[model samples]
Target: MADHTIGTVADIPQGTRKIVVLEGIKIGVFNITGKFYAVKNTCPHQGAPLCEGSITGTILPSPPGEYVWGRDNEILRCPWHGWEFDITNGKSHYNPHQCFVKTYEVSIEEEEIDTVTVDTYPVNVEHGKVIVTV
Candidate 1:
């Protein structure tokens, strides 16, 4: 397992996603609001391109006759059959424990310029870029 620098933050704007292929496996890096999350591109159901589906909020459990919309832009819906999954953790809304897509840890390099002490030697700073551990 290793961390892959798929692309910069700019490649996936807020409320959007960028799909990257690592070791022939498709993964998606999503920007929800400002945070980034990575998940497998294939849906657990029907092998659909999960990342290519729509990113939107889902309906919440509410009192009868009342409607509540929650988790805005934090849900990923499979285009093939509208199966919803949480993008942050890749848990299926339908059956969280039994059915779900694979999730990866996502990180971003520190935005500010800072010195890195390597072998007691200071080195140049690193730019802020999106990374996924797979």
Candidate 2:
């Protein structure tokens, strides 16, 4: 893994998306509810920049025989085609088998955001902000 320093934690606000260039790759960094996540900036459905999409919650089916519902708010909706992706795993909610985006490892150090790459890009969170380093 390779590490890179992108920016400070105050740069990104919660529930907003930011785009960065990491290792010449376009990456999208999101600060959702004080947490950070990273994924490919482009949407696979129509090649749109996912950073401009809507951030919303997702409903998941409970385990069999359970009459409860589990919900997650880490989903990003594509602006062009409305395709939804789970930010935590970078997998498409609509087509779980074949659709996925490149996700990066993120960490913080001394209130500074650091990103680690895994053949794709690197992203991190620092001081409550999101950062991406290519």
Candidate 3:
């Protein structure tokens, strides 16, 4: 367990992600909206490089024959097997409780002087970069 300053927030846009190798271990850092999340790059299923997969939302039926997509840029699908995992917590869409990807602790080193309002709450200044510790 160590802290590695992978990158800044601006490096990965709102709908994109960045991969950083720490101590020879690959980790995926994602920027959802403006928040940051980090997860182990290796997919629990078949040891695929999870960071190289596609990022999208989840589709569920709102009613009979009515499907709706939600959580845009919040889900990651493995390119190899199409396994869906939530970027927020690294949980597998299928068996989230039993089987899931490993999520790492992430924190942003923001410039404390500036703060921005998000909805009603205030978001700390991120200094245009993201930092991940794994």
How much does each candidate deviate from the true structure in C-alpha RMSD? 13.5, 17.5, 16.0
Q: What is the TM-score of each candidate against the true structure?
A: 0.80, 0.69, 0.78
User: 1-134 in candidate 1: lDDT tens per residue?
Assistant: 98788777888889988999998999999999899999999988899999999989988999999999999999999999999999989999988999889998899985566788755443454476544433
The global Cα lDDT (0 to 1) of model 3 is 0.86
The per-candidate count of clashes, in order, stands at 0, 2, 6
lDDT of 2: 0.80
> What is residue 95's positional error in candidate 3, in angstroms?
1.0
Measured by lDDT, the strongest candidate is 1
Query: Where in model 2 is the C-alpha error above 4 Å?
Result: 62-72, 112-134
lDDT of 3 by residue, 5-108 (tens): 87677788887888988888898999898888888898888999988999999987598788899989889999899999999998999888987888888888
lDDT of each: 0.89, 0.80, 0.86
